[model samples]
Target: MGTQFWVKGTVLCKTGAQVVNATGPELDKFIGKISYGLFHGQRLKQCGLGGRPFRFSFFPSLMEVIPASLHISVIFFCSVLIVFSSVASAFFMYNAFGSPYETLHGPLGLYLWNFICCSCSCLVMILFASEVKFHRLSEKIANYNESTFVYKTYTERFDRSFWIILFTFLSHTLNILLIRLAGIQFPFQEAKEATVNTGASDLMY
Candidate 1:
């Protein structure tokens, strides 16, 4: 979450034709590439004719410029993803190498944990994407603390880190299918079968 970014994009703005002091007419263009990740907030690389190319971090510096509530929500879901993924891993390890309970610590537990991790990963991607698109995140980050010029999103796309979470979701889904392939009945199916067997035995008695 902290290492890589979910979305990367560039913002551009064109300066006004005339200046107040007026050395000469000026129409300059500015462009900045911004990358937004979970923990590190956003990164900006300014490459424009108006100023020397530079780089900066947005969090704690321009933190107020972005939507705080939605950002926090993304972070929350990512944290949940990490926690539940770890729990699912531990359950897998125990189911393979250690003595497990018949129900909670068995196939049912594995399914439950994997499902949770999958759900959280999905939510992380959805919420982060929503924050970027609906909130106009790129434009906000580009225009932060800038009074002289306004910036517009020139290009935007999801980065590798975002797809990594998607792969994580797929992996959990695969694990669930593998559990079924191992000939273990789903919890509900197992319960229905047990109830039917019990009723048949009662009738025989």
Candidate 2:
């Protein structure tokens, strides 16, 4: 949240002068409406979860749903997808129970893999919706946009591997097969050249 210290500071100062030099002076006055904006702007402090300083992505206008100006279709689609994936993972994990313990080799490997993937995917979806920059409680209170704090908290992913490892985690499980239905492929084997007989290929072939 941010404070817009913009007030009509001009008419308070210039009375009739505004009538003659209305264009230039009026523009200056318009700029001065939020003179304190730059002031409060400097008071930025990084507070809460991630510790990275967050100012509002944009100065709040009269709109409350400014940041979420997402098309309902997009929101609805992603929301449904997230919910479906979450439930599917849960159902798969619950149905495909595995060994209670792990060894160097085992039959419950699928179960273990499913458990890992499900856990990681949930963590990632939570983090994907989170932000590293956090809102200071004071700032939120001042700007009246406390929800921004929650936004950052929800989408706080650290890096790509976090997601990759998450899917890789499930790749070992039945969810991997389901994800394959979605056309997602997880790398398992590394491609290698056929003992690239460099000398034989060039000289004999």
Candidate 3:
């Protein structure tokens, strides 16, 4: 009698079939190559049990998706949004503790505004970090490897939070642009000239 050794495992596929039979050696080699692919940030193509092949691609980094010429503009806008959001959040927090805002808007309203601004700022920061750090790429790899094999080339899309933060930022930027377009100066600047004239009139008197 001859002895035989057979190692068996399941190959997960996203489409067509859920489970396919695979040998231990094949699974080992496939997993080894996948580890290397993940380390080098490379796409992987592997064949499943039934001779079905699947491709896995990582999500492109932000810079890859964005043009170099517009890089500075993007950075500038993100920074401005972050700063303004932080400042607005702080202002709201301060008002939450005080008299006029507490009486008029109430603590809840002030706190709500504060939370929105703070959350928007934090979410923007996280998005910026993910852009540089390839966090989404890692996530894609994990998701594809979990219980299903991803077939198509991975495409990166902005999440809802990203759009929300972007819209908020753009709205604030538009407000500033409109003020400048309308030739509106700060109240302090308008008061400065009045103060100077009043001082001169007092001197004359």
Local accuracy of candidate 1 as per-residue lDDT tens digits, 60-90? 7656877787788878888888988887786
Residue 147 accuracy (lDDT) in model 2: 36
TM-score against native, each model: 0.77, 0.22, 0.30
Question: Where does candidate 2 clash, by residue pair?
Answer: 6-33, 6-34, 7-33, 129-154, 129-155, 130-154, 130-155, 130-156, 131-152, 131-155
* Candidate 1 lowest-lDDT run of ten: 19-28
* The candidate that achieves the highest TM-score relative to the unseen native structure: 1
Better of 2 and 3 by TM-score: 3
- Best-fitting candidate, scored by lDDT: 1
Q: Candidates 2 and 3: which is better by lDDT?
A: 3
| Candidate 1 backbone clash number | 0
RMSD of each: 7.4, 18.0, 15.7
| Candidate 2 residue lDDT tens string, 28-106 | 3312111122113222222221123333323343124322332222234334445545554554454445422212112
Ranking, lDDT, top scorer first = 1, 3, 2
| 1-205 per-residue lDDT for model 3 (tens digits) | 0011111112223332324444555443233122212112333344344342334322233234333333344345556556656665555445446544233322223233334444554555454445433533333443344454544222334334444555675665554444445454433455544543333312111
Pairs with backbone N, CA or C atoms under 3 Å apart (clashes), candidate 3 = none
